[model samples]
Target: MTNRHQKYEVLDGLRGIAAISVMVMHFLQDLSVPVLQSAYLSVDIFFILSGFILTHSYGDKLHHALGIGQYLKMRLVRLYPMICIGLVIGAISLCAMKLDGAAAFSVGNFVSAVGENFLLLPYLGDMSVGSFIRTSAHGVPTLGNAGNFPLNPPEWSLFFEMFASLLFVAAIRFDRRSLLKAAYASLALFVVYGMMIGINEGKLTIIVNQGWRADNFVGGFFRVTYGFLIGVAIRKMLDSDGAPHAYWMSGRLIRSARALFVAFLLITLFPTSIKGLYPLAILVFVAPMLIFQGAKLRPGGALSARACSFVGWLSYPLYCVHYPVGRLVFTYLPNSEQHIVGAAALACGLSIAAAAVLAKCVEEPVRRYLMKRFAGAASRSAAPPVRAA
Candidate 1:
């Protein structure tokens, strides 16, 4: 592929790795394993990647050719199919829980949860009553505190993602200098916000988990904005005349860099402690470095390229659906300390399988159909009428 059209296969692979790390982290959290405590930071990695990739893919188009409505439609088409699948799976799991006496069923709350989640909105109702009963009675798994998107907690990121996409489009209209200034301003605001919260709570760490609840939702906006803008800045740099060529590094060095990138990501995610400003540093500095490096490093061979593409294709589906699917697994399986590890492993395996099936059998087909249908309608509407002779 030409440079303009080339896919950053290494970045794709890294994204898949991040998604799996998050899945494992969630399972372990439910099972009471203290490992990978900071894996929730994977959402930051996602924000950066989304900014970088969308800028690369749609920056020029958004500025020159694509309309705001069409751009949003494209995003919805790409994202909503998997979201629907996740919502359906979550609803089914909730029903099963109620039927099996694992959870209390409230028709009003249940219907509200399904309706809100179906629209990609967080369920704001008081789930504190029936929701925690499962956790209390049977030791069934929960993501703690009925987060913003309680049905599928990880979807909190997706909500921020959509919001950030709109922000990105709006910001891209500015000149490069103005864009950079905006990004810097966002960074400043984020640091100030983090410090204020940390100091008020008498903690030294930058808060990474935000936007999952009503109180700290603003933090989520700052978190995603800063990360996304960093990504956009990296893309802008790479697109400039002085930027390094993709082939500047030798293939062997690129491969080594890829390995090191993965190692750094794992080290950052599997932190033993959440103290200090390291998490903030990683979000502000390390994530952009990874994106810049990944953009420059292509996959090594045909087999490697195929693997990267496959994993990248699988990442979104895996991320969207993993929580509900794994929750169901943990609900049914024994989650005792001895068997918890086994259960977590099984949950991960089953989640991957379900994600793959959904991607291949459902998400892909629906997206293609929607794109074709919408594109044809758009073209027809844009075409002018001919006069008869």
Candidate 2:
């Protein structure tokens, strides 16, 4: 294994760790345990990581030449397949809920809900079917808030993620010097916006918990901009001459790298039992440190390389599918603590398995098809003009 390929495996491992944390965190909702109290921070972590990976992968290539169409087509192929699958499964799960005695399970409502999910729109909106349900199974309304997907709640972040990716096309226009300056400017905007919201609303705006809210507009923007640009700044450093070697050490760095991710998993799975805006604290302080730490990871053994590669591949698929699968299990299967725990465990397993399936069956094939088209288009664009006699 080459050091080049290992560049972002640790980061990928963190993403996988976050995805599983979110899965368990949702399941633990039924049990009313606050384990993985800061697991919600995973969303912000993802926003930061997305910016890092996007810039790392495309910054140089796209900066020199703008290929917005192909760039976006690539993104769609990468992101939209699981979205489509989640929408379909969420629809089925919603219909299954109707059959299981939920009063809100009208076919008209089901169609509306599934349609919204397909658009990657927030399912917590006015037409949100999940919000109205009073199923006999849970007794309480199964939906938590209007901002989250009742059918597939975790996807709200992707709505923001997509928008952030689009913004990167604009970010590429600037050189590294200007990009960091822009990042700091956006960070200030984030701080100002967050403070205004917090002071006026008497609520913290930076932490992303509870699916969606109207007030989240400013806060969500800041959360993403700050995270995305900060990631770009980090990528700028990584892109600089002599960056990695300046920071690199030996195998102990590898263990430290692995331990950072282990800590993330442990924080997500276990009760920190710490109170007072710990999730916010993690977002404001700890998460960026993790990204920086992951950046410093050099290549280790073959096993380490392989593990990180798998982690990188699996992270996005796991994230995209977990919520719908978990929702299906919880809505249809059972509600008892023991049952929910088992269901949660089942969700974790099925998510891992389903992610592998999605990767092989959907992601890879679509990406190949899109890349082929993109190549053809680029070739045509690059072909020289012929002067005919």
Candidate 3:
């Protein structure tokens, strides 16, 4: 097993910031600022991070028996606890939203949704089964994810993460050549998909993010394919695509400081460009740059390092709990900007507290169990001891 010390401190901090960006973006977009409009790009950052971490950890070991199984277990242990909690919270909040008249309730779908919301596979069934975001002509709410009432909207990204991770395991078990081919093919598909979104919007664009629809969900697929493969490609290129080469990037054109700046800017600043092309710039350049630089980060001072670690530790559960926390609060509080500042602050605090609870009570324990029982077994199986003659 790789040492925990080897984990990238800067990337963890970036993820914490990104997770906060996502939550804040969701919270404030309706309240009028919308400065975090670009925060959705954080999804791409996550995809890149996933690919980088997965390849670094398992690229060479995937050919061994149990490697894939254990990898899946580790990922599931990390994901499922928070997912179940989010879904439960979402389901209960669905009733609350209905009472608040944010949505019209259906008993059958609610029961089914309570049962099926945890399905990790987006392709098997419609992800819109329980969505309740209102459809309106205005851009504000219209741009929202319109499925799965009170269910964590961001869970859709995790669905893509699961699918992409499965594909990554498959590629790793195959030869490097096959993985390269798959990456190229997926990239081609993403380009075609991006072009379609751009043409429809009259510029380079791709907007199907964290949404579930018959047609729009395809956008998420293309987005994931591009982001995840770029991650794999970057790691592979840094390693000279499996050939012998020095891993340090030449001349260090980009540094971890630049990475921190760019990632923060993407999440927090307004993109002063043709809006349609923003996602293109992020997916094509910025996200990958952040990952590359993040990989190269040297540990900073103790205070900064601890802050980064705390943010990283807070990120996952923060992400998992934010949407449901927002829903519950807004159900009782007004959804409009009537008390925008106070509303956002309250949602942020509640979400962070909920995340801390979940991380402490759920993810940590589940991960410890999986690590104790399966991590070693999986690692051992991947490089089984040779029997003596």
Candidate 4:
């Protein structure tokens, strides 16, 4: 029997893959290459994984040993360090652009953007109106049309992830039946929101491009809610006494499962004209299936296990830092269509290196310090008061 607290290495590897896909998608887009068209869907994978992993790790603790304040503190320690690193990178990138005269940069607007984004709040400016006082002034339009978190577009997802965490904590008191009801309610809301978006966009398929702007901000909520809760439900299933047996745990079958999982993600994320229910289907079915399978799959060997663990360790830092790093490289480097392919390739390598540095050198140390400090504070606060004799 597997240890309940052991890390799901396969899920971690899949998460790293998803993070890479997102980084590549953004890099290609910046270079005007139209590949990985559906890679934004990788964010859905992240939401699912977040739900699954968080539930697996904290489902019982939150109900017993962990208090709400302490849980939030742990989460903040895990997430906020990288966010600060990303914001600093973004600020530096903007300053570089201003120095290079590539775009206009306004200190006031940038300061405002930084302040809001640092708080993980969305930028409420008119992103389309690229003028001196708006998004353009902060160099956000050049990056990606000024999303909600103009400083770091991917940060919008992080915002939703944190929101989902809070929601998950709030529902900790729910019984199994109540949890299922909550999941179904969230699913219904997601479907309704998708249908509305599809109708308005004049597309038969559910639009996946959301949660980044003022107009489609609400869509982000439904997207994350559905995916995250589904993940939670799947975790509950896996934890139950009647959970399905993994008959496919043999070496050959394990390899096949790993291969198929990678192939399926590639196929789903590649450019395709197949629309309509495709995106919604992936979220509703594909993502959860992968998580369920990932939870059951073991690495075929020690080397493979180590590799997966490394990538999983790198995933969050990579995702958080890649956009700004790539943007910096693309902005300063040669980026003609012919040359840009090479430039993007180089940027990818550099992004990996940067992620490693940030993760090991910066994020880890900061998080350790913060967690240690928080733990000390919590222990002291919980200590008994001295009695005067």
Candidate 5:
């Protein structure tokens, strides 16, 4: 691989790592263990990284050209196949819960949850049908019930991601100059909105609270835009060809400084607290782009490259399936100490394998088919203009 490709590999590895953090968080939760209580914050890591990827992939299109229709089509093809799988899994899980005697399995709740999942909305706003029941052969409404892993817990993030992608597309379709300007403007507004709600209610406004509370508005908005903007800003850096100094000393120094800053922020700040220090976090979020230059990767020959790339390749599907599988295993375990650890490991491993299979067998083929079709159409359309010119 060229240096550019190797650098992308580094980012890919980081993406896998972020997904793993979330997987571990869910595993801990399911086993009733305490580790990385803030593991949920890994979503923010994903956000920043995704922002960078988007900008890298499509920033130039937004700047010098436009292709809203084709861009959205590609996004849909890339995102939807797995989502459809998740929805199917969720539906089957709900049926299994009905058999388990989970009382929340009422026809109404079942219909509502399935309906929401189908619509790509939050199931029951914040609760999922599977989560509401927790895999008991029998379902009952009680305080002991912690509803997670309903069908596809990881999908909630994807919904936000898809929405963010649309925002990016809209920037191009509308011929908006400086997408960064647009993203920053939205970020400022969201932070202020979050603060206003936080102050008024004396609590943070976290969107997607299962019942669609107004307080959750800021939370949801922040989750979508913050990471999306981070990605956008990174694209800006790459566009200038690792700007502010060109090659060697300038690029190296910029990359190093960004890495240091990102590390400091990750160690020092918490996602929940981002509401209070929103402005500062925005500045801090740009570090990843600086560090992820095409030339900075130090690939350790062959073995390391394969290992990192493998994880990167599997990360998305692994992320999608791990949480629900964790929940499923937890429900079956007999609540013994030894059992929990063993169960967590088994669940994680099985989920990762299952996700990999799905990715390879299902997601990749579908994505390829769609990409070829879309790219063909795009090429055909452009040919007419060229010939006319």
Candidate 6:
């Protein structure tokens, strides 16, 4: 067991911000704001975060006796609670939509959409499932096109996360160095491919509806693999103790701070031009400090820590529930930009509250039990233990 404390607070804050961005992206029309339209970056941020965490947790024990089944079970328990809640809510709203003649009530459409989510196929470039914003098979009245009553609008991303994790596990089993090299090579290939297809020039819409969109999903894969490898590489570098000055030295802090600030500025200012550089910049600066600093806190840090932790804990569940909740809230409210904006904000807030409650009351206990009873201890028999500092 490593005696280092994981920076749970920092991770929590990042997750919270990411989830909020997704919510805002969905409600872009309601907010009547054009500048914040690229909230989809939140999804990318999440992929990076996932990569970071998994690498931190499992990288040192890459050859440990962890089994595929345990990994999959943990993911299932982590995912199922929120998804089940969202499904029930979606089904009810869909029924109402059918009753009101808002949707055609095609059984095929409904089943297909539901099954796609349940099977986690949407993340793989599957378009059979409708976006949460559009009216689905139930024809239920939605909050414009933004609240499509899909069981969970954000679920497509979850599938990708799961797939990436499994692939990473396989990579770890063979050779970590090879995995890193392959990830970098794949990313280079994607950027070249994207430019060839004019994705960098903003013709993504044209390629998305056609047969060649497999590359569209490649971006997502790159995002996850890149971030994960960065974290693992950083860990390995630090573990070798090759740096001249200690990581906590004042000089290192100052240099790292400058690097992080520059990276953030570049990404926020010119997102499209320097899309690939920002993560590397962050890795250069932030990752080292994070590994060394662990979870050190200042006097007022506890309050912020709790708030961020709450948000992070609720983020996944809130994401699962937001689409249906937004749809229901909008049914009674008007549909103008401002009205829908307010409704969406309210929906986001309420969903967060709902998720927090569910996390505390249901998710934690159920997850613990499932992991103990059904996840199979033999699967993770040689897994490393993570200990607090």
Looking at model 3, the pairs that clash are 130-148, 130-149, 131-147, 131-148, 131-149
TM-score (all chains, Cα) for each model: 0.85, 0.80, 0.81, 0.85, 0.73, 0.71
Off by over 4 Å in 5: 1-7, 30-33, 61-66, 101-103, 124-150, 170-181, 196-218, 241-295, 334-338, 373-389
What does the lDDT come to for candidate 2? 0.62
Error of 1 at 239 (Å): 1.1
The better candidate by TM-score, 2 or 4, is 4
Candidate 5 residue lDDT tens string, 119-229: 767653334243322444433423232232235656777777778887776543322235556666766665666566666767665221221232343356655675566
Candidate 6 stretches with Cα past 4 Å from truth are 1-5, 29-31, 60-65, 93-105, 123-150, 173-180, 196-219, 235-238, 241-300, 335-338, 376-389
Every model: Cα RMSD to truth: 6.3, 6.7, 6.1, 6.7, 6.6, 6.1
- Give the per-residue lDDT of model 4 (tens digit) for 129-240: 2211121223343332567776667888999988988988866565545666676687677777767787888878655667878778898887787777777766776656
lDDT of 1 by residue, 52-86 (tens): 77776677677456677877777777778888888
Model 2 residue 305 lDDT?
64
lDDT by residue (tens digit), candidate 3, 1-389: 33312656777778788899888887776644465877887888888777766776667667555556776776676677777787778767666665555555367656665565677544323223211222211123222323542366677788877887787875544444555567667666766765676577676554434334434567677677667776676666555544212224421555555446554665457644354455665666556766766666754677777877788888878888888777677657644336655777898999999889888987678766866676666654332211000
lDDT of 6: 0.51
Residue 13 shift from truth in candidate 3, angstroms:
1.1
lDDT of 6 at 364: 68
Q: Score each candidate by Cα lDDT.
A: 0.69, 0.62, 0.63, 0.69, 0.54, 0.51
By the TM-score metric, which is better: model 3 or model 5? 3
Residue 94, model 6, lDDT: 58
Q: Pick the winner on TM-score between candidates 2 and 5.
A: 2
Better of 1 and 5 by lDDT: 1
- Kindly list the per-residue Cα lDDT of model 2 for residues 46-128, writing each as its tens digit: 88787777776666567445377767766665577777776666667666655654425445655666677687776444433
Cα shift from native, residue 200, model 2 (Å): 7.4
Q: What's the residue-level lDDT of 201 in candidate 4? A: 80
